[model samples]
Target chain A: MREIAAVFLSTVRMNFRDRRSLIFMILFPIVLTLILGTALSSVSGSSDTAEKLDSRAALINQDHGAMAGRMEKFFRSPEIRKIVHTKTYRSLSTAKADLKKQKLDAIIVINKGFTQAVENGSSKKLDFITSGDMESSLIKNITQSYLQRINAYRAAAAFAPQPAAPLLADHALSINGKIPRSSDYYAVTMLIMIILYASAYGLNVVREMNLSPIGYRIRSLPVRQINYLIGKTLGQLATVFLQIIVLVTFFKFIYHANFGSNLPFIFLVCFLLGFIIILLSIALALLFSYKMADTILDLAIPVATFLAGGYVKLSILDTNPIAVALNSWLPNAVAQNLVFQNIYGGTGQTAAGGVLKLTLIALAILLLTIAALRRNNHADLSK
Target chain B: MIIEVNDLIKRYKDFLAIDHLNLTIGDGELFGLLGPNGAGKTTLVNAILGLTAVDHGTINVFGEALSTSERAIKKQIGLVPQDIAVYPELTAQENVTLFGKLFGLRGEALRKGVADALEFTGLTDIRNKKPSQFSGGMKRRLNIACAIVHKPRLIIMDEPTVGIDPQSRNYILESVKKLNDMHCTVIYISHYMEEVASICTRIAIVDKGRIIAKGTQEELGRLIEDDQVVSVGVTAPDYSIIEKLKRLPAVKDATVDGHTIRIVLSERKLNAVLDTFLEEDLTITKIETNTPTLEDVFLTLTGRALREGAQ
Candidate 1:
């Protein structure tokens, strides 16, 4: 145990002392975050950005179930009235004509059996017939948020101490009908980017690791390889956490960056991503030579970061078909989207599902690292 | 036996690193592995440490099979590599403490071991200093301090004196002797003949991945009691006279370099070898007779290419 702790602490100290790693991991991300956030502050959403959505939306509820009636009541409530001015119509054709005439910003059609589908836990169709997706996505998120609250209310009402309401109107307004300011957007993405950069820590330690001269003295001790490896991973993981914490705290206090209220989930995503990168870089440095691993990292990290929209949101995956068709399941991309959705209350991507996906990636990288180390026995690591 | 190896063979593709070598070190023995670079000194050491896979060998450390009991065996052994392996970012005390802790020392034992290690290596005054702030000699001492912090039963020093000044080298060498005196078995590996001869109680001359000669310093000197080199400098070293000198019964082999005729011959029959030189049509410009040291015996045995007289 002492041996493992020693290795763990020593690895952390080594990583911190590695000037290049420190500059890239901690300092680079902070500076970039500040520059990108401040310069592009007005782009995402400025002072006039949070203006009312006021999208003239037509609500055509075809289902006679109480659930569909409740949806109608929600659209007429003051909460939805503050965002979308809803008008009721009996036929889809009439609403479609009004949408075509530019009289309505969107037409939301609740198909029949919506209540039955909810009760059966089956898929329910809620169509957003709007030409502009950017505007419709917010109203759609509000409607989806209402349905989720209904499901939760139903689940919780089975043993209710009191007959509580089916939904709280505030959740439907999670989007606040406005995208974040550039300062807020970059603040979150830059933190994610720093988590990705923590892979340098893994590369540095594994470069000296294994049975090489620099590591041979450590390996020569009585400790087992597994303990040494675990100690290494924990140390790198801790460094990543430290970097994230320091950056987040600095950005929070000094820059007043909008990290949203969901700090725990945001941090969870960062932690998992940090773990995957650390293990992945370890596998890279072990499977390949240090120089080769470094080259791969240098080539891969920035490209992946760009694809994940770390530098700037140049091409959104939803809008750009080519970007969406890339078929790469980038953990950073998933993490960013997950954080974005959780904060603004977008489509129903359960936090558990995203976390599990990141966890699976981490596990796979851990396995790869193990396999790499197995083959790396007797292989020179110092070079 | 502290460590015993039998029929160890290690091959790297086409090149053979350790060639069916064997070695044994007794308790409290200051054993020396003397070899030039690539002579398999490191390869053999790696095999013993279970770092390299051997094709055919059984290494027993502390009466336990090395392969089956590597961790247990390593727990009792400390290795000081040829290169300085201490972390440059860590302080002298931290480096020693980390190594000791890794070897299972804790609390008071850990603290004492670290302090003792620093004191033993004469680095107590700079315990808080990093390797970047230290001289090469200080770094070398720090390297040794890291290895023996746990006070292992056997300490393997692999050319620990290389690249350091004479004073530092002497200090390390004396430290090796003192460690052995404290009943810690020391494997002092080096290619420097004088250092090995002066310190190691039992020295093994390694060449071509084999122990060419291994014994007490006095015993190895006797291996060449009858061996002597006679150098005769001539104005014009005739290539023809070299063949004539070789024909003499006492002269084992003779060669001429520049303008000097060198003969490897028995000391008792030196006169016979010299008589031919007098008969030659050349005046003996200079003549010198020198007895062979253990290094000469090694060079003659291995027939390796030149290093002057160092190896």
Candidate 2:
């Protein structure tokens, strides 16, 4: 036990002494999160203005009757007008040219037969043209809302019934009557990435085994192999734990990230996931031999992050077969999903199952690492 | 006995690295495993240290058989590898302390052990400096320091002076003697014949996975005829000069290369060859006769240079 403690403390001290490793593991994650988070939040908060909309869309109006005037007035309603600034174009060709130049998000064309088609109960096509994929979903939603309101007005006139304007209610799902903000998602993702990165760095402690001096010293000593490995793994866990704590504290105080009812639970999840990642890293390090441990870690961490839905939304995994497969097995994915679900009060059965799944995966990796170490021991002894 | 090896056999594929080797090293004996390269010196050391497994052998260290439980035996052993093995990233003191802990030393004991080892290696002043910042000699000394911190009862040094300045080599030699004097059983393994001759009390010369010779320096010296090496530096001579010198009965062999002639003669016939050479009017610019050394014994046994491996 004393020998193990000594090994653990020595590993920790060595890690702290390496400046590049400190920056790569502990500092880079926080810096990357701050840069990306601030940029995304600013973009999401900006309001759309007339100039912005004009640059994004082209409009053509051909309605001439009173009903057409009313429809146009409805399109000019503050809610719709605020989203898109319409421009009258003499021809569709000109609108298309601007769209081709990428100076517009879309071109809106209202045909001369639109009002006549509505009166005669015939459908008319509203053409929208754009070279960009952005704002397509928002444009579609607003167009549907406009058509619904117009249909309601027509029914009121035809039935001689007094009808009230359709009311838009805030029916978004909430957890305990409080909706989750974007910051919550950011915090969970950032925590997972940071913890994984830190663990990856700490896992490289095994690389010291390749040092002939260290190898000779250990081989010549009375320390057990299992005790040495456990000491190293414990040291890595300590490093990851400290990094997660600092990151979580920074998230709460500096970034103002929302931590829901299960803050301690989230931290626990992070710790467990960190342990899994550290074990996986150790297995990988042993598999490739300690000589290439750092290189494998460099390649594996980013790839693992990508598979865990680090850069993109987790929903995107549905369309990515590899990501879907990895997400099911990845400890980081499981832990992140669990934390996100807990924050949103989402009762996902899969989320509940993740805790057990990740723990088993971590155990499997640790077993594989021990097996690798044993094999290495035999090989060295043979040499 | 501190270490005993009985009928040890190590086979790699079809080649035997150690064959039917039997040896015993008593406690406090500064034993030397002397051999040229590829003589199984390292393999024997590795077997003793449990770093390599012997095919058919029984090794007992400190009364414990060489098995899993032999870890206790390791606590009494210190190994200074042929290669410089100190951690480049760690200071000399840290390296010592780390290895000391492995031997069950801790706290003030660990600290004092590290300091004592460093001071013994003449590296106490540079204890706080990393090996990367150290000179080659300093690094080699630190490597030895790390191995000896726990003051193991048995210390195994494998070619500890392979590549270093003369001063450092001398320092290491002195330290080895000091360790032996302090009652540590030292196993000094080296290819340098002179090094083994100077420090080893009982020397074993391994050749081709077998002990060709094992005895004190004088005992091994007596195996070969006490021939004296005679060299005479002269101006470039004709081929007949070498032919004529070879015909001298007192001269066992003669070779003339470049501007010098080398001759080996029995100690009793040294003056007879000198008189013959002078009477023959052979230009004797310079001549000197020296007693046989370990190199001569190795050459006499293997019929080749000491550095060449035995076939």
Candidate 3:
């Protein structure tokens, strides 16, 4: 027991002593908490009390196709007008000026031949311009989301043997009755990215014990292999858990980011997310060479975050039912949804489900790590 | 006996690492396992430590068979690996204390062991400094300190002075002698014959997974006891003259190192060797006849230089 604790304490001390690792694992998060926290606070600070804010958007229809006319009418309809103050612009120059002056949150220009392309089963691009703020970016995604629905309906209409007389029928996607403030979305996304990057902790600590000469010395001692592995895993967990605490506290005190009424639950969700990331790093360490583990962690975390809708709200995974089914089970996606649900007043069922998925993944990775270590006994003994 | 190996055989695929080997090391004896690189010295050490499984053999350390309980047997042995195995990120004191705790030393015993280890290695002044901040010699010393911190009954050092300066090398040799003086049995493995001859009371020469010879320095030196080695220093010695000297009836081997020519021959051929230099008109600065060294014994038996494997 004492030997295990000594291994654990030594691993922790060694990780802390590595200045390069400290910069990425601890200091980088704190600095990001300061820069991103302060920058996002200005965008989210003004509208804290309300669940939704009225955003102003401009529409420019330059298409001569039948589908383009229908899309223009949908933006001017009463349903979109209630949430977005829409204005029709005659030219692109005026819309650009309003966006520059912050008068417009976003501007959507439906390109010519959009309807023709949809009719012929070809692709056409839409030009989107925003004020470069989080709110404006959300507005831009919303506009693009509506365009996606029109294309889907067009495809459905073409599939029917009997063409409907009214090709420009009205279609809508359901909203959850409450839209989260853009600031809350910003805070949650940042937290998700930070938690996933917790893989750095495992990459450093495990590789030190497994690959370095210190490892051989430890193996020659009376210590068991299981005790050594357990010590290393716990050391990384402590480091990542401590990071989550600092980030959550920073968001709370500095940005006044609301995590709903249940603060402990919010903290618990973040902790689970860190645990999952650390387990992933351990599994990765077992799979790849020590020199390649860090590089893999560096590339995998950011790419995972991007796919889980960390950079944009209501991403492709949100609208595509098939994508939604696949991504919902991913650790990053599950954690992302959990943070959004907890802060946006979601029912406890979704949050519980997300926690369950994360817990299952952590446990699975833990088992695989143990198996990999056991299988690696002969190779390690030779060294 | 502190360690006994009987008919040990270890094979990796088709290659045999240790083949049907037998040896015994008595307690409190500085027994040396001498061999060139890839001569199964390390393989034998690993087998004795229970780190590797043998195909058909048994090893007993401290009256306990290694195949039985490894952890219990390992507690009584200390290993100083060939490589410097100290953690670069850990301080000298932390490295020692951690290893000490591995042997069940706790509380005051752990602290005292760590202090004594540092003082013994002459690294107490840099106790708090990390190995990365240390010189190469200092890191080597730290490696020894970590191994002996637990004060095991049997200590196995495998080429502990491979790449350090002479000062640090001497320090390590001195420490090994002192440990043996405390009745700690040591198995010193090295490719350098001089180091083995200097400290080890009993030496075993291993080659090709087998012990070809084993005894004290004087007993082993007697392998070539009939041959005489004569050292002759000449000015601007020509290579052809040394070749001619080797062709003499009494000359068994001749080597030229700069201006010195060493000839191995019978004592009766000393006058004949000197006459060759005179006939060749080479100036002789010095001449001396000496006894055979361990290197000579090794060369005579193995037909290869001890340092050949190093290249």
Candidate 4:
């Protein structure tokens, strides 16, 4: 035990003495968090401008009758007014140019004899034009719904229309419900990214195992292999814990990050998350050769973070079999959803279940890391 | 006995690093394992220290097997490696004290041990300085101090004088002598024949992973019968002089190169040859005689210099 403690102290001293590692481990994360947080905060305040939908369209009305007037009235409906800000263009060429320049999302053309054909019980063809690869899917869906409502109104007129005014009023006003802000989504993403970076710092402990002169000295001592490894692990855990405290405090007080009602619970969750990352880092240091550790971490961290839903919504995977399977098993994804749900006032067994599952996964990873270290110890002895 | 090795074999893949080697060192004996580089000296020392595993034999230290009972054996052994092993950040005293604590020494005892080791290695004035601030010699001294702070029963030094100034080398050599005098069993490994000759009571010459020769200085020196090496400056001696000296009953071999005549002769016949040279009226500008040193014996047996890698 004393030997282990000595080794631990020696490792700490060496790490503290190395100026570059000191700055990288202790100061770099805080700087990154502050920069990203401030940028995200500014973005959150600009949510209003981002929520306005563009609706500039070209109208070629060939149906010169009541139906054409009614269609124009439908476009000017109060419901559509809340959802889209529309502009009219006369020609397809001008409209194409505008759509190409991103001034319009699409163009709508009413074909010739459209109202005459509809009155004679014949189907009328309406043409819609859009620039290549524009975000026309949403416009397509809304247009289809509008045409369906018009068809229903026509059917009611034919059946025995009794006061279709209320139906028209309902169709005139667009549903103006607010979608979630992009900044909120980005903040969640940035938080997940910073946490992963913090976790990568734990890899520094593994790096110390190979680079530290103190580690070399310990290897030459009479100390048991297991004791020396335990000392290193404990020392690294302490470092990660300190880092977590600093990051948590900065996010809480400085950036006013809303982590939600269970502050203590959140802290516990983050601590366990950090602990598992540190253990994995140590295992990486032991399993891979030193020269390859950096490369491996570079490739692994980003992929793991992305798969854990750094940018995309986890619900996008409701129909994706692979994503669903991984979402249930991957700790980072689960922790991300749990923390976000907690902040958004989601309280239920499902949220708690996700947290529990993530905790269990972290525990399993830690156990695997310990087992790898033991195997490495035996190999060292034989060597 | 402080260390005993019996048929120790260490193989690295297909090549044998230490081959069926047997050795023993009594308590307080400053035994020297003298050999050229790659002669398995370091390998044998590492095996005894349990730093490397043995393939087919046993190593006993203080009457206990070192391979299986490493912790017990290592607690009583000190090693000053050829490389610098001290912490670059810590002062010499701190490094010494840290190592002492590992051996279960602390408080006043630890302080005294550090001070004594520094004093013994002649670094008392620089104890508070970090190893990075010291010269190569001072660092080497600190390496030794750290190893010996716990005062282990046996101390193993592997080429400790390598790549240092002569002053530091002499200091380290003197310190080793002092340690041996203080009743510590020392295992000195080096390729320098003179170092082995100066202080070793028993020297073993290892070559190609095996002990080619072993004995006291005189006993090994007697391996070659031609004990007298004579170099004479003859003021441009004629080629006939080499032929004439070769015919003489006392001369084993004689060669004439330019103005000098060099000869090896049996010790008993050295005087007779000198008398014959004088009688022949040769203009001998210089004459020097030397008994066969370890170098001569090394050359005689291996047909190569003992300091194979010396610069």
RMSD of each: 7.0, 8.9, 8.1, 10.8
User: TM-scores for all candidates?
Assistant: 0.78, 0.74, 0.77, 0.68
Q: Write the per-residue lDDT of candidate 4 for residues B190-271, one digit (tens) a residue.
A: 8888988998888888877788778888889877655677889887576766777777876666766578777777555666
lDDT (0-100) at residue B49 of candidate 4? 69
Instruction: Look at candidate 3 and tell me the lDDT of residue A254.
Output: 73
Expressed as tens digits, the lDDT of each residue in A1-383 for candidate 4 is: 88778767765665556667556654665565455444533533443322444445556566668776676677677876554445555666777788788876666777777676556545565776654221242343345456555655666767834312211111111212222233444444555555555545556555544465444445556777677677766665655556556656666676565555576666566666666666766666677755575667677777766666564433233224676566556666666666665665322225568667867877887887778777665552222
Q: Cα miss at B185, model 1 (Å)?
A: 1.3
| Candidate 4 segments exceeding 4 Å error | A34-217, A254-267, A306-355, A380-383, B106-108, B122-128, B225-299, B304-311
Can you list the residue pairs that collide in candidate 4?
A78-A172, A78-A173, A79-A172, A79-A173, A79-A174, A80-A174
User: Tens-digit lDDT track for model 1 on B1-311?
Assistant: 99899998888888777888888999999999988887888888878787777888899999999778787898889999988898887899988888888888889999999999999999999999899999888999999998888889999999898899999999999999999999999998888888998998999988778888899988887877787877888988778898888788776667677988777775557777667777876877898887777666665666442244324
The candidates, ranked best first by lDDT, are 1, 3, 2, 4
| Two-chain complex of model 2, DockQ on C-alpha atoms against the true structure | 0.51
* Chain A TM-score values for every predicted structure, listed in order: 0.66, 0.64, 0.65, 0.58
What tens-digit string does per-residue lDDT give for candidate 2 at A187-263?
66777887777645544556656444566657777888778878877887877787777778877778777666677
DockQ for all candidate structures vs. native: 0.38, 0.51, 0.42, 0.23
lDDT: which candidate is best?
1
Ranking by TM-score: 1, 3, 2, 4
TM accuracy, model 4: 0.68
**In candidate 1 chain A, where is summed lDDT lowest over 10 consecutive residues?**
A164-173
Q: Comparing 1 and 3 by TM-score, which wins?
A: 1
Write down the lDDT that model 3 would get: 0.75
- Alpha carbon lDDT at A28, candidate 3: 64
Going through the candidates in order, what fraction of the true interface contacts does each contain? 0.71, 0.77, 0.64, 0.25
Stretches of candidate 2 off by over 4 Å are A34-191, A194-206, A255-263, A291-298, A314-316, A342-352, B88-90, B106-112, B231-287, B303-311
